[model samples]
Target: MDHLGSWRFLKVFLPAVFALHHFCHAETAPYYSFVQEATSAPLVSYYDYIIVGGGTAGCPLAATLSESANVLILERGGSPYLDPINKTDKENFFLPLLDPSPHSYAQAFVSEDGVYNHQARVLGGASVFNAGFYSHAETDFIKEAGLDGSLVNDSYLWVEKKVAFKSPVLQWQSAVRDGLLEAGVLPFNGFTYGHINGTKIGASIFDMDGHRHSAADLLEYADPMKIKIYLHATVPKIMLITEIGSRPRAEGVIFEDALGVRHTAFLTKDSESEIILSAGTIGSTQLLMLSGIGPAHQLEALGIQVVMNQPMVGQGMADNPLNGLFIPSPLPVEVSLVSLVGITQFGSYIEAGSGLNLAPSLVQWISKSLVTILNQTEAKVNSSSLLGARLKVGIIIEKVNGPISTGHLELQSTNPNDMPKVMFNYFQAPEDLRKCVQGMETLINVVNSKAFSKFRYPTISTQDLLNLVATLPLNLRPRHLNTATSLEQYCLDTVMTIWHYHGGCHVGKVVDQDFRVLGVDDLRVIDSSTFNFSPGTNPQATVMMLGRYMGIKIQQDRHS
Candidate 1:
C-alpha cells in the first residue's frame, strides 16, 4: 500500500483488529445473581472457592473457577455500574479517579511517606479507575513467577478477548510514537498486547467509543448458577481453625456489610477448598496482617491473636515512581488515554495522554494535585482560574522501571476499613533515582525530536519551552539545566505514581510458588500483592491473567 493508503488503513481499522479477535471466545456474562446490599446475604454460606475482593483479579478468578467449583466473592465496595461519576465515556475517565466522596469509586489516601494516592473502592478495582493501557507481563517476570509459558499466553487471550480493546493511534499519540522512534527507540512494534522493548501501541480497556471495559466485565465467563457475588461486603479477617501440632487452616472469613452487620462465610469441608485473597496489593497485605499472619511483634503490639509468625507479609512494598512534562499543543489536542508506549531498555517506560477540552471535574483535582506536580509552595495558578478557559495541552510522562526502592506496611488501626500505613520510599534507592534521570532525559529527547515540532509554537524555541516547564519546579536552579543533578532533583520533587504499585504478599517470601500462604493451609493470595514488581507497562493484564491461570491450575491440581 502507498503511504497515504497505509495511513488511511491504520486510522480506520487498527483499533478494530485486536478487538475483533474475541469472537471465537464463547459467551457473555451470565445473569449471575448480583447482591447489591449485604443485608440480604444469609448469615452463613459455603463455597469451594471463597475469593475475597471482587476487583481486577478477583472477578476473573471467580469467573474461571466457577466453571467447575462454586465461588463466593465478598467485595468491600458497591457496584460502579450505577455511579454517576464512573461513566464509560472518555471524558468520565478521570472523574471516577478524582471524586473524593466517601462513596466515590476511588478511595483517597496519603501514604505515610507523604505521597497522595488513590485506590479503587468500586467492585472492578484499579482497572475501573486506571488509564486502561493493556500489555502482557515481561518474559522475565513470567518465568521468575514460575508461570507456565503456554498457559500464560492462553490466560492472556481469555482475559483480553473479554476486556481489552485495540486502541487507534490518533494525532497526539501518533506524534509521540514518531518522536520515540526518532529518539532511537528502535524496531517499532506497531500494535501488540505482548510486552516488547520498543515503541508500540498496546490494547486498551477502553473500546472504540472510548467507553471503558473493566475487569468486572470478565465475570461474563462465570457459570451463573455457580457464582454468588456480594457487593458492599467487606472481608475483615480470614477465620481460622488452629491446632497445636498442625498448620493453621483458613476455614472461613468474617465480613461486614454497609450497615455494619457482620457475617461469616465459610469454605466447604472438602480438603482442597481454598480461601483466595485477590484484594490487591494494599488490601491483601493489610488483610493478612489483620488476620494474624504478620510479624509477631506488630501483632502483639496491636493486641491481635497471632495465627502465624510470618515476617515478610508486608515487606518490600514499592510503587513505580512517575514524573511528567506538560507541553502546550499549537492546536486543540483531542482527549486520549495511553495509546502509545515507548518501552526503553533503560529502566523506564514513556507514555502520554492529551486533551484540550477538559471537564469541570478536573479543576478541583488539578488544583490540589498540580500543587505537588509543579512542586510549588502553593497553587500559583490554581485550576479555579481555568473555569472557562480553553487551553490545549499534552502531557508526556515516564514511569521509572522498578520494584527498585522498597518499603513496608504496618497497621494504622485494627479496623479493616482504615487505610494501612505503608511507605513506598520513592527514589530512595540510588539506582531508582538514576533510572528516573534516564527517563527524564528520554522524555526531553522526545520533546525536542523533529516529529514533535508541530505541537510547539513556531515562535518559541524548544529549549525555551523546556525552560518554562522546568521553571515549574521550585529551588530556582539554572533556568535551562542540562545537568543530571537538576533532572534528579525534579524527579525527587515531583515524583508521583502511575498507580503500578506491587509487593507486600511477594511470592517466595510470603507465599509459595502456587500462591498459597507459606505458613497456612487452604489460603492463597492471587493478586498484584503476589508480584515482586508491577508487570510490564501496566499490571491489570497480568493480574487478570494470573486469576484465570491460577484458576485453571487449581482445577488441575484438584484433579491430580
Candidate 2:
C-alpha cells in the first residue's frame, strides 16, 4: 500500500486515540489520533494547515482540508460530551446556556449595550447550545458573498446529510404553523430547508431521538490520519512574518494547554500552507486584534505589537434584533424548540419555541431585568409571582433583518480570556426598527388567529396580550421599545438575541471575497465573522457549509 493508504489502514486498528501525552514523547513519536486533550500534543508541532477554534466552521474546515493535508485544531474549551450542558435531549435544550460554571460550553457576556449573549467555548461551538433550527442561506446571500451558487448548494447538501433532519412538529408547533397560515404570512411552503417567504417546517440539527448532531460530528468525514484536534487549547496569537517587501504572512500560532504550558504549532514548508481562524464573530476579531493585525492605535493602546495596522478588524459588529412575547399556555404543550417559522413580507422572520424549561435562577435573572424596566416603584417581582407556578410558556419571537446598525469591538486588556467590549447598537438603524414593528404586528395577528385561540386567552385583545407580556419577567427581555431611549425604544428595550450575531472581520472591510485577510498572506478568517449579513434566519447551516466550501476552494488553490 502507498504511504497514505498505509496510514489510513493503520489508524483503524491502532486505537482511535493517541496517549503519547508528554511533550517529549509526542515529539519523538508521530502518530494518528482524534479528539485528544491539549496535554497530549507536543510542545512543538507542524501541520499543512492549522485551524483555530474547533467550532461549527472549524470542524468541517479541518475535516475537508484533511483530505489532502495534515491539520491541527486548537480549541479553547473542553469536550462536548459527558456534561449535562451538552446533552442533546430536547428537555435539556437550555441547560448549556444556563450552566453556571465559568468553563461550561457556553460563556455568558453582557454586551456594552447591556444585552445578555453567549459565546460557545466547547469544541462544537454555538451549535451545541443553539435552537438547532436549520435553514439555507438565501440565494441573495450567496450572490452577495460572491460565492459559487452551485458549490453553495452542494455544500449545503454536504452539511444537511450529516447534521440536518426533518423537524418533528408537535402540538404547540402545529398550532404555530396553523396560526402563521391563518395570519396571512403568505403561501405556506410546507416542510422545507429553503429560505423562503412563508410559513414552513424547516430542518433541525437534532435527530428524531433528540440527539444533537453538531459540527464536531463532521470530523468523522475527515481523513483520520491527517487530523488532530486539541481540546482546551487557547490560542493567544497568530505568529506572523513581516518581510520588508512582502505583506505580513501568518506562519503558525501560539497556544496554551489547560495546564498553562505554552506551545507552538507551525505550518509545513509548502507555499500553500495556511492558517485559518474559524473562531466565531467575537473570537476571530479578538484574535486578529491581539495578534497585531487590527487598528494600530488600539493594538498599541493594549500593549500589543502592531503588525498590519488594519483599522477594520473589529468594526461592523451587529446582531439580529429580536423581539418576542411569552404566552402562558392554558393547556399542556409538547416540548419543542422553534419547529415552525413565519417569514413576513417585511425583513423579519417569526418563529416559536414551546415548553421552555426555565430554571428559578434563570427566571430570577430575567425578572431582575423586568424589575428594572418597570419604573413603577411599587412593582414587586419574583420568579414565581411573574411565572405563576410552571415556568412552561410558549415564546413567540420575530427578528428584524438588516439591523444595518453597526458597532465595534474594543479590547480592554491584552488578556485572551477577557471578553471584548462589544456593543451591537441593536436597532440603531431606522430600517431595523421599522422591520421589528412590522414583524411584531404580524406576530400579534398570529396570536390573535383562531388556530392559536386554544393557547391564548379568548378575551385577550392585542393590547391586553402586550400587557400580559409586560407582566412576565422573561418577557421583560432588549426589547424596551422606547424612543425615549431609538426608534420607539421597545426594540432596544425588549431586543434579546436569538444569538444570530455576525460581522467584525466582514467581507470587503476586513477580508476579501475569498475570506483572506486583506493585508496578510496565508491567513484567513473563515467564519460568520466575515459575513456582512447573517444569512437567512439561521447562520449555523451556512457557517457549516462555508467550511466545506472553502476547504474545497483551498484544496483547489493548492493544486493550481
Candidate 3:
C-alpha cells in the first residue's frame, strides 16, 4: 500500500482491535503491547505546528490543521474522558474547576508582583467551565477593535459551521422571557433564541442530534485521533528560537504535567515552524511576559532578560458588562447561569429533542432574546455602535474602550503557580460608563412593559433607587447616584462581569492585527486576548471562528 493508503487502513484496523481489547480485557492491568499508538509515533525533533491550549479555539484549530500536517496540541489538561464536567450530554459544565474532580484538571497562577492572577490547568481550558453560549461582535465591535470587518465576518461564518450551533429547541420556563416581553423589551432578536433587548442568551451549545448543545457535547462527538487532547498540563514558558528574520521565531513550549514532571515540545527543530498561542487572554499574556516578550520595563522589574520589548502585551483589557434584573417569579425553577435545563421534563431533549430543554428556548429564557433579534435589523450598526456592543444574544454587553494605558500584566515570580498581576481598569472610560447608564435605562423600560406587566414588579424609579444603593461600593456610590433618578445608580448597582474576558493582548494594544506578538515570529494568538475590544455577546463562537481562521493561516505557512 502507498503511504496514504497504509495510513488509512491502520486508522480503521487499529481502532477496532483496541476497542475489543479494552472491553474484553477490562480487568487486565494496563495492557502492554508492541504496537505503538498513533500519538506516540515519534517525538519528532520538529513539528509543523504547535498549538498551546486545547480550548474553544484551540481544539477546532488543532483538529482542522491535523488534516495535512503533523500538529502537536499541548494542553495543560489531559485527554478528554467521560466525566460530569466533560460529559458530552452535560450542559452545566460551568461548574468551577477549583475543586478536585475527575472531569477537570485545575491549576492556579500567582502574579509575579504577588498581587493578582487566575489560571486554568485543564485540557479543554476555559471551555471546560464556560456556559457554552456562542456569539460574535456586531459590525461596530470589530471596527472598534481595529480589525478588518470583512475578514472577521468571513472567519466567523466558517467556524460557526464547524461547531454546528443550533437554536435552543426546548420550552424554557417563560417567566423570564414573559416578564421581559411584558415590560416592552420585544424579544431583542427573533433569530436569537433567548436574546431580549439589553439582555443576553445563556448557552449557545447544541446537541449532536442538531439541537441545543454544550461544549462537552460537541467535543465528545469529534474524532479522537484527529484531535488528541492533553488535559491537566500547565504551560510554564515558551522557548524562543531567534532566527535572522525581522522578528524572533518561537521554537517550542515547555509545560509541566499534573505529576510535576517537566517536558519540552517543539514546533520545528531546525527548519522554521509556527507556534500558535490559543491560551486565554490571561494565560497567553502571562506566558508572553514570562518568556520576555512583553514590556521591557515590566520584564526588568521581574528581573527577566528581555527578548521582545512589546509594551502592549497586557494592555487594553475588556470584558462584557453584566447587569442582573430580578423580577419576582413564583415558579420553582432551578437557576442555571450556564444553561437552561427544563426541557428534559418532557423528554423532548432525550426523545425528539424539542421543548423547554431545546437550545433556542434555553437561550431565549436567559437573555430575554435581545441580541439575537437586534443583530438582524441593526445590521447597519457595527461593533462600535451602541446596539452592537450593548445588545447581543448573551447576557453580557461587549462594550470596551482604550483602558488606562499604564495597565499591564507582569510576572511576580518564576514559579508557574504564581498568578500574574491583572489590571482590568473596568469603567475607566467616560464613554463606557455613559453606555452602561444608557443601557440600564433601556433595560428598566423593557421590564416595565405591558407584555411583562404581571408579577407586580415595581418600576425602577427614583424612589426605588434607595433600595439598590447598598449594592454599590461605598467609594463608588457618590458617582453612581444622589437623587436616584439617574440611571447611573442602577447601572452601578447591577454592573458585573459577564465573564467574557478579552483584550488583555488586544490588536494594536498588545499583539498586531494579525494576532502576532510584535517582534515575535511564528507565534500567533487567536484567543480572546487578540480582541482589542470585547465581543458583543458570548465570545465562544467568535473565539472559535478566530481559531478556524488562524488554523488556515498556520497550514498555509507550514506548507510554504
Measured by lDDT, the strongest candidate is 2
Best by TM-score: 2
Per residue, candidate 3 scores C-alpha lDDT tens digits across 1-560 of 99999999999999998787567533221222211222343333356777777776776677667666666666655433333322433333323433435434444332222222235555455555544555565566566656555666676666555444544533222334443444344433434422223333333554433222322223433434444444555677888867665567787877665667666777655354678888787778888888888879888987877888877787765554444343322122232233321111111100011111223333333333223322434233232221221122112122222222224465678665665666555455656566656545544544454443443223333233233332323123234344345555554444444455676677765667777776677787878887655553456766766676666666666578
> What are the lDDT scores of the predictions, listed in order?
0.80, 0.81, 0.51
Ranking by lDDT, best first?
A: 2, 1, 3
Q: Which lDDT tens digits does candidate 1 get at residues 1-560?
A: 99999999998897676345333221222234654577788898888999989999999899888999899998888775655422645655666666767887778787766667787777789888788899998999998998899999999999988788888798889889999999888779999887899899999987786767888888878888898888888887899889889989999999888898888898998999999998889999999999999998999898989988899989999999888777655566777889979999987899998773445644433434433433332324343333333346678999988647999999987888899888998888999999888888888889888999888654444444444445453222233344324787677766777888799998899999999999799999999988888899988999999989999999999888
lDDT of 2 at 544: 97
TM-score of 3: 0.68
Each prediction's number of clashing residue pairs = 1, 20, 78
Models 1 onward score TM values of 0.87, 0.88, 0.68
Candidate 2 lDDT trough over 10 residues, lowest sum: 20-29
Ranking by TM-score: 2, 1, 3
Q: Which is better, 1 or 2, measured by lDDT? A: 2
After superposition on all C-alphas, the RMSD of every candidate to the true structure, in Å, is 10.0, 8.2, 12.7
Regions of model 3 farther than 4 Å from truth: 1-45, 78-80, 85-94, 97-120, 141-165, 169-189, 192-203, 206-228, 243-247, 269-272, 334-407, 455-490
What is the alpha-carbon lDDT for the whole of candidate 3?
A: 0.51
